[model samples]
Target: MADVHELQSLLGSGEELTIVCHNNPDPDCLASALALGRLAAAAGIDERRILYSGEITHQQNRAFVNLLDVELKPFDPELVVDRSERSLLAFVDHSVPGANNAVPEGTAVDIVIDHHPAEDVQARYVDHREGAGATATILAEYVRDAGLDVDATLATALLFAIRRETLGFLRGVTAAEYEAGGFLHGHANDDLLAKLSTPSVSGATVDAIADAIDNRSVTGSVLLTHVGRTSERDALPQAADYLVTLEGVQTAIVFGIIEDTIQLSGRSTDARINVGTVLNEAFGDVGSAGGHREMAGGEIPLGIFADYTSDDDQLVAIVEQVVRARLLAELKLSEEDGGE
Candidate 1:
């Protein structure tokens, strides 16, 4: 059982609290932040703020927020964060600093609530468990254990986040996630949940998919693709996830140049491989990146490479080669000798 008293004590102290999800607001992130906010409110913390850095790319995520009427404000790095003011910041779903879903410059993080393994923590209070399927699941447990009344909208958000992050309980999830999922299943709004499951895809998403599929190159069970100039960084990971579902594919790597950064995402359906290790081993020195066993992502600064075309294909090929080599090395398959 969590020490609700500790969490409640943190909230009841009249300190300003800001709840933030990673830059790209996925269902799990959105759900976790809102659930935390709900908990804080129950503890009489009325000034709690939920801030987001990136836009909601998926229709389902937007719809989920709309249905829940969650009031999330856009994160402006310029919003003066006074360190001396004794403010508290809590992050959900992601742990890395400067991540797309992370707060911009000049924000102080005080607490972290996450399901992913802690890559690095600058926060004062953190609860990180890689075993939990979704951050929302952990938050759900907090609300339930606190005996707080969770509304239908919040329950729907939790259910959607748990379902998506766990891939309907087929991925790296735990018993606690299942218990929270069961609770949400009983209370969530059925109509809102259904709508979020298969929301309408925008033209930009369609174009992004076409480009990703068209650029794909398959080697063994791995499919590598590039999408250029993505307005939505989260779409790259989602696209990589989509490619892994192909008939012959067991792993997928997608790269894109968003602004000046070379972003990469990797996914694997196979149980024998850990994509997180592949990313950390390959790009850890260049930039911050870490994630779960099967899925991971990272980014590299483009300025390091010389005379790079900055074209999507060229940039992707570079990132892909690095990731592929690292994955092969992790799997004990190399260019010189293919081990049996």
Candidate 2:
């Protein structure tokens, strides 16, 4: 159990606190930040800011923010400097500062609340549980333990966060997550959740899915596809989710070029192979990668891809081949054996 009382004690009177979400925050991250903000306010903290650095490019995520009315500020270094003496920085959903967050390495962090695998993050207070499906689950525990009143908005956000993170209890979920869901179900707005879950998709998303289906390759139960250059990076994950539902597929690896970097998203139904560790071992040398047991994502700069070829088609081909081969190898499925 995490200690909410200790957290309350950390925020002294009149001190400012800033809660930061990881880059490209999803529903889980946003919800966790909002819940924490409320907790801080309840603890009598006068000044608090919820900050995130990356764009919320996913339509569902954008809808969630707008519909839920969760307030977030764009991260500004000036804010940290202005309140340096009185500021206490806390990270939610992401533990490693500068790994996938805007915070730089070596900067002091006051608190870390996350459900991701633990890393060596130096913070005054840390609560990390790898078993929990969503960070929002941890936040829900805090709200419940402290006997804090969870309004409809906060309840809906937390409930939605758990659902999204766990894929409706289908992936990487534990008993605690179910309990958290049950707790939030009574308080959350069911109508708002229905609206948030089913947002309108753009033409780009459909085109991306088509590209993924056309370009997909199968090896045993693994499906690999590159959606070429996608305008919306979120479409990669959506494509992966769709691909994994295919009859013979137990794992899906989807990648697309956005801006200058190749964005990767993977989903796995097989419990034996940890998708997060596979991604980390395969791409950690070249770029950043890590997540939960069932789903993970990564990014590699185009400069690295450019090292092999300058031709656009050749670059895409080489990237696809290299990434697929590396992933398959990591999953212990040989090309000859996995191929249909």
Candidate 3:
């Protein structure tokens, strides 16, 4: 458990606090930011704001925000730079200052609270527990230990965050996450959670999933596919989740091009294979990639797309071949092994 006293002391008095979430903020990131904002309020910080840079295009994430009335403002680089002297900056649900997050590189961070693998980032206070399932679980501990008031809205958000991050406790979950879920269960609104769980999927998501199915290639227990062009990057993860459910499939890697960037999402049920590490090894050299053991994501700019002036199908086919070969080689699989 992190020292609540130290966190409060870092905030000091009459200092504005800005809580920055990672790009394309998920339920865990949003809920963790809100929960920490509540902590700041309890610590007597009057001026504080929760900010995120990327779009929240996930249906469930949108529903969670609407159902809970969680407020998050857009990050303003100018405002952050201007307020750098008088304000304190804190990050939640992300460890490194700039990796895959809105915070600029080399920015001095006051506090960092996360559940992912820790990176070598300089911060005055960092509470990173790689064993924990969700960052919300860490914040829930602060709320519990400090005896802070957790309203129904915050409790429901925290509980939902934990559930989504852990895939209803089916993924990487520890005793701390279980305890947090149990504690938040008492205060969370059951009706609201049920509503948030059943978000309507968009047509794009359906098409993306179908494309993944059509393009899927299996080598032993590994499955890889490309969904072509996608309007929503979140659909890649949904497709990857669906692919991993196929019979005899131990790992699934799905990729799609979104706005001239190739986004990849991977899921693994095999305990011995860490999908995050696999993605980092495969794509980290050319792009940014990393996540938890069971789930991970990465993105690479589609500069190669400009090399081909041919039709879209041809371009996608070439890119898919390149990506598939790289991933298979990293996974120790080969095309000659009847993958296609």
Cα lDDT tens digits for candidate 1, 93-164: 876556656555435676678877665666666778787878888888888888888788889998889999
Model 2 Cα lDDT, one tens digit per residue, 1-340: 6898898787654377898889989999999989888888888787888888978989989999999988889988766545566588889999877888887777778889998875786788888888888999999999998788989999999999999998888888889899998899999998999999999999988999899999998888898899887788899999999899999988899998887888899999987868889889999998889887789999887776767676778888888888888997898887786555
Ranking by TM-score: 3, 2, 1
For residue 312, give model 2's deviation from the true position in Å.
2.9
Q: Which candidate has the top score in TM-score?
A: 3
- Pairs that collide in candidate 2 are none
Comparing 2 and 3 by TM-score, which wins?
3
RMSD of candidate 1 to the true fold? 3.2
Candidate 1: list runs displaced more than 4 Å: 77-80, 83-86, 96-108, 120-124, 305-307, 310-340
- When summed lDDT is taken over every stretch of 10 residues in candidate 2, the lowest stretch is 77-86
* Model 2 root mean square deviation, Cα atoms: 1.6
Question: Which 10-residue window of candidate 3 scores lowest in summed lDDT?
Answer: 77-86
RMSD of each: 3.2, 1.6, 1.4
